[model samples]
Target: MDSSSVCHAEHVPSCHAEQKRSIHTGWRADVWTASSLFLAKISLRPRIEVALSTLACMRVPVAFLLVLALPICKSFYCYISETLSTACMPVVVFVAPLCNAAALASLEALAKQPDISLGVISHFPQEQLPLHIRLRLAAHWQTASALNTAELLYAAEKMHTYFGKIDVLLSTNEHVQEALALIREKFGIAGMRPDVAHNFRDKARMKQRFFEHQIPCARFQRLTSRQAAYDFVEQVGFPIILKPLCGAGSVSTFFVDSYAQLEPALAQLNPSEWNVALAEEFISGAEHSLETVMHHGRAVWQSVSRYLPNALDVMQNAWIQWRIIVPNAAEQVAYSDIRHAGQAALSCLGLETGISHLEWFRRPDARFAISEVGARPPGAQILTLHSRAFDCNLYEEWIRLMVYDQFSVPTQRYACGVAFLRAQGYGVIKHITGLDEVMRECSALITDVQPPKLHATPTGTYEGDGFIIVRHEETAKVEQALEYIINTVRVTLG
Candidate 1:
């Protein structure tokens, strides 16, 4: 791919054909590589004058001049913004994991907005990201971790003079939503108010809000003391699930099959880690997630997906594996009940605009009960599948919602699914078996694949060590291929 195509592939803005001609593909490298370097060391008057003269002498289009001379323009823009205070661009504070190449590419769609200055607040440093992604970020501030909101806020404050005012706070990962909301309030910025943040962050409070709206969900109790948990179990019976009042990724979540099971789980939990604990009556049913994109208090796009064996079970039992299926035809029709519940949950949350990852269950009687909702995009390559299935860049559209308050592309053209491969036994990964069989059998149906590395230790997430995404026009075909993959692929550790 050419430089312009590479830009679009990274979700960056592309130069027009006329602009491309000015650079003249073969001639660009040697000239601009030298020009951009010399462009940086020069000063204001001489910089623009020489840049214009060089471009005019070469008959380069002005837009191509901006592309080749991006560094010059950037330094110039910063000079004006910092010195003359003449910059009118809105400054947006973005927080998300920066390690993944795909995530970085998607995020670049926002960071490279020409008229806007993006202040990236991340747990990972620029060194952690690829050079292509690192170069795109206008300003970067690293934190000790995602929880270090104070560090992020202070950095933003220090950058205000240089970048004007931080207008909006945004995060693609749900873990940072509450922090983003708090930061927005602290800085007098706009978007996703702190008051509205609770409906997603605090799962116990979220269930209460949903229940208040007459939305069907499992019975839950917010508990502080051990006695309260026991009392909840007495009333609601055994087989309860205990989790942090505010948590993500089913981390530290416990499943209690009986009083015997409850005691050991209770003894292991340290209440100090989480401010509050949640004990809820566990419901037996199939699990599904309602993916919705909201704009101005209304859902403009929605999709339904089912999980294999459920996340909680997958976490509890090391042997259990899982996959997510974005349903086709009849499954989508059957998921209409969940779609209704998810819409109601968002309406009750009262969030003006954002993405919702709402996990709900369908009981044996066909009753739909909400599990939890996160005010962010679903993880585990769900967005990747959504993009392939819909023939749109879901990540780019998601960033648009965070930056522009709307989803530019709005249609689904296919169905998609992902099967996560994990080690059945725990230890350092020693070998992977049945890979060639699965890949060769499923190659045509698979869009992406990453086999587990030979010696890396396993990450104890639902995603496991590696995963393969399969997509097709028919959801049934996708489902069939996923089942085939999960059954055949094996990661063995010793």
Candidate 2:
């Protein structure tokens, strides 16, 4: 086929236009040679052939390299795209693993197209893969899997064998350092490097940093022994927060209101394993979080969210409910100062070029102080909600920033907010009410409403029982709708 025909056949409109332009400019011969080399492999693979062809038409060198490498090395690309696609829609996935697998399987089926080649592979053990391929795969997997797991070690060794230019590694979990080292040796990306992730994961160390930085935070001390904890209370007084240093999702987080409650609280923990706990002066106020994208020592995009009734209190109650508010324009001025302070704190901590979730408290006087900063996306599907409200794909933005050092600036077209619905009392969930009505009534302003399914009881208050994320061109409408939903909807349990 002629180059134009080939471009059209490959569904690369841009390529055809460019080819026509080049021909008119007397560069037809050179253009044809390049196009031929690019399309040489289009006939080789059917499943990803289209993706490959699209990449070829765009003349993306990395795509070409990956295409060439695919045949020589057994590699699988897992697309979590479906997760984002179906997230905002009204759908209940009772089984998370099943949903993930089905999504991957459907993507695999789609890969059967003439333009696509690679297929989705299940998360199988290393032993199932070819011995040669197993080595590199092991290294990448070690970052996600437990080090003690056999698969992790296998992956680490495999990673070391392939890409060896890495130098530094960062992990919050102490159990994964050895795997990090192995992967560093294998791929040479960099040896394990000390980072704030370690300190953030270790509650005691995190508090120490805050103290050293003179960052406003609760008065706190860490203890490993029961006697020490008791002594700490004697010195600092009662009613403190206690939790594991490296745990997520508020797991095992408890509040000791008095010395009388300390022992029972301690009983719930394994001092030998849980080891460390923080005794801190509890600050009473509204809790809010600043989500930021920092680059080159500056915060580029920042979002401020106020937790309804507060997350700490919600976690402490463990049986009550909570929601979150993304302030409208009128409240922006008040929160902007907090966002600036958060950005400054992140800058001081040497956090640059990544997404950060910083929790803060706004005291009665309107003063703000940092609670903690995590070097990852905020939990509770917040990213999805933000994307829905702003018409921006944060994950995609993050990927671009990480890979290409570029991000899209969001057009502030509408104000968006999410309010989480939580169980009123502990028991099996009888039902979730008001989602249909909320969607129908606020259809003009509400972008998405995802309520917990019937029988989907929550195990903890912080489990994100359900959420309603909305976007409105006018800030007043957004606020009114949010108030209406909060006042009307109820998550009842038997």
Considering every candidate listed, which one attains the maximal lDDT? 1
- Kindly give the stretch of ten consecutive residues in candidate 2 with the minimal lDDT sum: 89-98
Estimate every model's Cα lDDT from 0 to 1: 0.73, 0.55
Query: In model 1, how large is the Cα lDDT of residue 401?
Result: 76
> Candidate 2 lDDT, tens digit per residue, 1-494?
23222221112122332332110111222343455577675675675788778878988899667788786554222222332332222211000111222232222222222221111112222233333322212121211224343544443343223222222233322334344445445554432223644654565676677777767777766667677677777776767777665655556777787878888877876454347765666677888888898876788888877776777677777554455666655566677777777776676565667677788888888776677776656766566556665677676576455434677867445667776677776676787777778878988876666677667767454745777777776666766777788777787778
TM-score of each: 0.81, 0.65
lDDT tens per residue, model 1, 208-289: 9988899998899887777778899889888899988888878889999788888777766644334568888898999888
What is the lDDT for 308 in model 2?
A: 68
Q: After superposition, how far is residue 350 of candidate 1 from its true place, in Å?
A: 1.6
Give the C-alpha miss distance for residue 55 in model 2, angstroms: 38
Q: Which stretches of candidate 1 lie over 4 Å from their true place?
A: 1-86, 97-105, 111-115, 271-274
